[model samples]
Target: MDKPKRRNTETDPWSGLKMYTAARIALGRTGTSVPLKESFAFKMAHAHARDAVYSSLNLEVLLQGLHAFNLPVHVLHSMASDRMEYLQRPDLGRMLNQASSEQLKEEGSSSTEIAFVLADGLSATAVNEHAIPLLQLLVPALRQAGFTLAPLTVAEQARVAIADEIGELLHAKLSIIMIGERPGLSSPDSLGVYFTYAPKPGLTDEARNCISNIRPEGLPYSLAAEKILYLIQEAMRKKLTGVKLKDGIGLLQG
Candidate 1:
């Protein structure tokens, strides 16, 4: 009987497609199992995803970076006391703690047209990396459009819905939260933005619009800003978001 022929990855039919994407497409096999290199690469990607999930955001560094925007910034915390509790009790992560609530106390209703919130969601790595770069583009465009902006709020152990309460407290008609999205094996640092009109406590996910994958490699900062700004303008005009609203690429041009 002839010896079993060895497989060479270079000759694999799918190998040519590897250059087009970061996805796992052409991993060659060793007999019936994945090759050692592919298996090791997958494990490393998995480790990165786990690390991103458990990572902590450096508040001081983040705050410093945000200071360039020349807006008042506050650090807030969710009802969850720690990462463990945040993971175990997701509901707690969606609400503000007593002190955080007090911090927003004096903001009267309709103080601003929009409030921007940054939260260390499932992937702090994402917030720490992409949040500011995206904001750099977004804030200026919003200002030029004559939108009144509220102070920036950065929260810890937070979930997506926490922005609703923050926006409510800040008395903003619209609330935008830039959060770290759940990490995938290939995307350990994907950022997501959720915006809602008439933000208030107890609002559901259906009341918001999301712009996701704001990392440089995923959705470039400029493009993300464009999409977000378009949503903001339309939401302001239409006075709604979520399922009821739709994306319109036709942004007004000068």
Candidate 2:
């Protein structure tokens, strides 16, 4: 018998470009509906995104990793009380609990160049996976620049702004927070960094500069560190962040 002809569905024109990214693209369709494989893959991605949102920070692992940095580490909480409250009452997550506030005031250093904060935000899995690695690369650069660093603060059930209070209490000139970014179907475990000069309570988003999508598959640790270091140096030199401090990497580099 002659070899049988195999059946093939219509292939997307962009199928060749699919290899360049993890984005959903070029899924070959079967008849009037999406192929079962693509549908299932989408469902799986959605599940991963959802799981990232609900995940808890593994503090023990985080603390152990932080200790190697040799800075006094303080674990704090937002007024949200729990994950549910943190999600529902965003205002509460912007401030620290009473005891946590007092502790920072008492133990935190005075007038440091920068304060590093790690917060478990929308996706704790992101922080658990990427925060330390980024910090490990950036911290040494800060130290070499003769900048004084405040104690490392780790906050659970927290949001980005809570670092403002931490930096203010510590009397830090600048605050850089590494937080878990909200999950997306294609990027469930993305870490984000927010750098603010002259941080204080009640400051809005415009007062800070954000470096987002930090991950091995996205922005790798070394490049992220380089950008952060540049931002910090520029922010310190210019006494500002936010929209004013543009990222001038190679252009400004001598």
Candidate 3:
């Protein structure tokens, strides 16, 4: 006689009965192979576990991603041989060196209507990525509106206050500075834009207008550029900015 073929189902009637009974009791219905992993509860539990891991890492990775833009603008440190010296000396970063200042004085036009400065304030990566695209958008827009942009400058070891210095140096009617903001573990490579009408030393934050969070995850580059232009126009008209201007104004507000 041919050997009996083994069945996929339980051969023992009692065992099969017990499994069936347990399935009905535990799951309200059942078949073989519990199917626990395929259930909705298992999927939801797995998703939560993945999310927990991502939340722990936070925004630093996202900020670093901004550096991938690989912009073509000149970096001040590359042009200056003493980049490390300036970084070590905060005072040096606050003002252009004698050579650079003199160069600007000689080559810079006195009738400059607006000045654009890019600075690696805290995160060079942020300025390298966001600032270039923003300027690409802004420079053309301003030009179309019949405004002249002064020779652009990229400052090394720059602080936000340097905008005032550049504005004074160029005699620009308005100065716009794109700088890297203080990196948070949550937001490492964020960029900030500061616009000042007639910037000068000792000018408070209240005298400047700021558009911050210019990264892929924060403010998109195109939108940030437009807002900066709008703010510059308003600042020129009102002769003031910052807290004095109406808050909650701009394309982003909508």
- How many angstroms is residue 32 displaced in model 1 relative to the true structure, after the best TM-score fit? 1.4
Would you estimate the TM-scores of all the predictions? 0.92, 0.94, 0.64
Where does candidate 2 stray beyond 4 Å? 1-9
The backbone clash count of each candidate, in order, is 0, 0, 0
- Candidate 1 error regions (>4 Å): 1-10, 107-110, 250-254
lDDT of 2 by residue, 36-58 (tens): 99999999999999899889889
Candidate 1 per-residue lDDT, tens place, 112-203, comes to 99999999999999999898888889888999999999989999999999999999899898999999999998999999999999998898
Once fitted onto the true fold, the runs of candidate 3 whose alpha carbons sit more than 4 angstroms away are 1-89, 247-254
**Better candidate number, 1 or 2, judged by TM-score:** 2
lDDT of 3 by residue, 1-254 (tens): 99999785534445546543312223322465445644665456456433322221112332343233332222232222354554566566666666666766676476667877777776766776677677667777888888877767777667777778777777888888888876654455678988888877678787887888898778898888777777777777887777876534544567
All candidates' lDDT scores?
0.91, 0.91, 0.65
